[model samples]
Target: MQRAWVIQFAGLAAILLLLAFALPRYAQMVPEKIADHVQHHLHEKGMTWAGVRPAPGHSRSVLLNGSAPDAEAQQAAVNDLRSLWYIQQVQDTTTPKIIEPYTLHIQWDGDKLALDGYVSSAEDKAEIAEQIRSEFGNNADLEKLQAGLGAPEYWETLIHTVLLKEIKPLPSASVRMVGHTINFAGKVATTQKAEALSKALRPIEEKDYHLAVNIIPLDIIEPYTLHIQWDGDKLALDGYVSNADTKAKLVEQIKSAFGDNAHLEKLQTGSGTPKHWETLISTVLLEAIKPLQSASVRMVDQTLSFAGKTDTTRQAKALEKALQPFAAKGYATSVNVIALDNAAVVCQREFNRLLTQETIVFSTGGAGIHQESNALLQELADAAIFCAGTTILISGHTDDVGNEEDNFKLSEQRAKAVKGWLFRQGGVPLERMKTSGKGASEPLADNDTEAGRAKNRRIEFVVEGI
Candidate 1:
């Protein structure tokens, strides 16, 4: 009986020892099994990019790693592992998939609606395409939609509520979404429609997303007319432009040229403006009117007429020739720039007649003028004032009464005396008058007789810059 008892004790002790040895191995295997099961679960759920492993030093916990397509997928994986009987805890260490510069572009051009760029998922792509097809008819082109990650929150809401809603009433439009930014451009039939669309887009703008809206109105007016007149002191602008943007650009150009003296009179905006109309108006204002003293440019329909006054025939002819190219390209140009030389010629004749009536008497053999000639000098100045901007030459002549050198000196001094008087009393600029001394070089009758010498010793005035 004692031998049997010893054998039973030894067997029991050996069994206990065997259990102690195998239990540690089984415990280790349990973690491995849990890891395998977790990984299989992830695979069944289509989380191919994810992996799971038993937590170090912890038997019932797992660490999930790798990239998830979105936050929802990562959370779902964690929840799924936690629901398992063997998993006490789940440590999710997964990152969201990255897509840089996530973008979506939509365009509707009267006949066709085209959709392109990235969407968050295949479901999102299908839904967006369906929405576009329903709203814009079957003309939607959705072949370019590609599934990607990194879309902003409520991205589809922006497209459906803001972009599509605002652009639906337009004739032609395009909307682009890149990251948190949205840009919309379109053309509407009236100003009221454009304003309403702009107002509708305000909600998106207020949400701190970068938003840009460009809505153009297509109101048309018949027989577009623009008249610009510069009457020496003030410039008047009366016109009809294609749109507000065109009107702004035109006004800016006018302000740049005419400064604050420009008066805008009933300048309105509408469609039906000729092609390149702004370009033609700018050319006339900037280039053609530069040399004109008083200018008028008129545009009615396709015809552009320019009438101005310049100082010379050369300027008139040059301006007319420059504007001729517009005529060759379907634009009718009527350029009538009158030269002021005819008025200058009439002034010259009047001055010459005044000088012939009574010569300007100076101190004998000196440069000083006599007080008796003041009335005639005043008359000459009044005549010169009428032909403003004309260049006048004040020439001094002397007879053979003195040495040639002395006569030259006297003639120059006399011419200078007359020029100084004109500048001081007549308000004539010194730059406008040129003085010369002919010193008996040019003879009126032959400088031999007393009367001929007196005529030769007189002063002469010539008008130039015609």
Candidate 2:
């Protein structure tokens, strides 16, 4: 029994070893067999036979690697193999591909511009250099090291007429032309300039040739600098300007606006500053805020930075609005607008607190101001004076104890009485004040309770026209 078991085990082991050797041999011979079959057919067709490679782990797929003078001849060889049923798949690996025409490039930096690429002829090169000089001004640094067969007639015309003109305004720009496609990149001084350049190139877009543009605003150092200081007592001005004439005009305007209270130490240097800069500072920035306690204005390059304290929030808002034109034109700006303690905002909060704690009581149903509200009214008046260029809105309300018509009439009368008191006692102008009544239509608390009703029957003040 033991001898018979050993013979069975040996026979099984031999069969396993045979499979390991035979499978790889079969895998190795596949490509050779396919090569033979492919060669036999290729010989009859007068085509040379290149080697064949079987696809890894795939039984029928193979890579028929070969080359031909042209794509048409290569396709013909591939089509011949498709008729045979044995080869399931064939990937034709061929060489000598069709390529597009070469590209040309031009780069501009500061005052210098460099051109490097191929052109069809020496005349085309000279023409391109001349075109650059004309478009970018005579001061532009130009270098051309381009060579090739005479450029295509279309390319030569496009560079001279359209592309050169489009990139002229850019302080720094690069242009690349690939066949019919042209791409542009550069820096402009304003958002409007960038948009204008983009709009101009829209006509150049076509099915055969394409045009692309990218422009970033120049935001380094601005042309001039403005240094303004308000030291809680008086204002001081100093910094760089475009020229002596501009400085004289600006100083005169500042003196006119603030009178002898301001000091000027400004120097004029003809940097790259904008023409409308004086108008921007004296007209927009300074006009927004008056009666400042402390402030400073600094402008560098195309950016404006200001820090200061105003007596009221209204002044701050006006200053922000005044700077809108600069922001819209792509001037980077920042403002630190600090409202003083005596500002209207602080007074407004105090008024709200006083009204919430103690109601402005009137005698019965009459439009008489009560004595208890004397001190608070005086405080509200003091706040109103500081908040210049704003209007005061006084609204009155009453609990729903009577008919709607009677309640509305009483509210209106009470509001008018308060307005008269503010005008007579507080000295606030009538044109800067308006009075209204809601007859308990708008309430701060539930009217079902006595306390809530007391809270609802009150006078409220709102600041408008800020």
Candidate 3:
């Protein structure tokens, strides 16, 4: 009976040993048991932990500090052969503690970034870690920056949130924060931007907010004004160029005879009447100032005349000289010399009686128009002779450089407007005229560069059907 009992006990002992090995592992992973194995082994071997700080991944397993004398030995006690697999990196560090001789602390983990605690020399303790670069030098992930903290989620959240955010003790020209309240006082270019920022920060409703921003607009300085218009023989000052500088310039150009010319300032004021002799006199004087038909200025209003019977050659020279001032200032002209002569009364009379007639167009426009083209327009308009049933086709066109759709719209609109002015504004019947739009497609010049583009962007009128 004793022998039989011994055999049964031996069989039981063998079975128990087999179960011990089999149950601790399901396939290759018994993680809970592994942790217990590691913890128990380390404790038994007198391993010490200095810190368990945050790192940059989902798992918080990275050790920032340990005071184990042998990393492999400690790992062995924990049932892990991981440190021994890479023998060169298992650097041993120790400090003089009473219990153990030299407690080795790991200085690095392969070529990966080492946190502040990884650089433990007895003398080394920097607030931030010095990055231990990899052996593969040139092909480094230069832009992949590493930051401190444990789990990656924690570090990612921190960096992203603070990229452009005003950090605690926010920096600024005139903003101050106390507790959760912010006070701002300074000039801002626009109130809209400030209000937008305030709206974005409204999440912190408990915080008090105060802000003051000033706004200023600068749009009054015009480059230049269209003050004067003249054909060769006729001239006029637009009553609209009444700014102080333009008025002063016009007065200065007329010199001694035109002192304190009140019309200069009242050009756009529209106070003076053509029936008033003084106003009429000023208009006639301005008209006579054009050089195409020279008439002597007498400061005379009622009997404004061109009575000089000097020969044609001498007259042309004097007329050209008189026009020189307007010419230099971009008022080119083709005023009828016959109108200025005693031969004719009106520009139409001049064309019918003394000169051949042709349809003419005139434009008094901004400085951007070509000087030569502008001079031609005025000369043509002044000399044009119209009759009751005469077909006057004043075909207007614009420069061909804007958004394709917008240019088409503009061209058509302008053509319709000119047709309206001829029939309604100028009182010519609608059926006698028409309009057309040939946008940037019909450019007379190249559209490749600025100068050509400017030239292409012009307004012109031609006699189409007539």
What is the clash count for each candidate, in the order shown? Answer: 0, 9, 21
- Candidate 2 regions with alpha-carbon error over 4 angstroms: 1-102, 106-116, 121-154, 157-175, 180-225, 232-234, 240-249, 260-279, 299-306, 310-466
Residues 17-117 of candidate 2: C-alpha lDDT, one tens digit per residue: 99999998997888668867786677678766343566565667667775453454466678887777888887777553222475778777757667666
Candidates ranked by lDDT, best first?
1, 2, 3
Tens digit per residue, CA lDDT, model 1, 1-466: 9999999999999999999999999999998899998899889989888898888888998999988866667777888888889888888888888777888888988778887887787778788877877788887788887777788887877777777766776799988888889889998998778878888888887767888888877776667898877767788878787778877887898787778788886889877778878777777455677557887788898888776777787877888887875786688877656567665776688678889999999998888999999888887876676566789999999999879999988998999999999889877888889999989888787777898898888888888854
Better of 1 and 2 by TM-score: 1
For each candidate, the alpha-carbon lDDT, in order, equals: 0.82, 0.71, 0.37
lDDT of 1: 0.82
- In candidate 2, the residue pairs with backbone N, CA or C atoms under 3 Å apart (3 or more residues apart, or in different chains) clash, namely 120-149, 120-150, 120-151, 121-150, 221-301, 222-300, 222-301, 223-272, 223-273
TM-score between candidate 3 and the true structure: 0.25
* Model 2 weakest 10-residue run by lDDT: 141-150
Is candidate 1 or 2 superior in lDDT? 1
Off by over 4 Å in 1: 1-46, 57-61, 75-104, 110-134, 137-157, 189-192, 216-466
Greater-TM-score candidate between 1 and 3: 1
Which of candidates 2 and 3 reaches a greater lDDT? 2
Query: In model 2, what lDDT does residue 416 have?
Result: 89
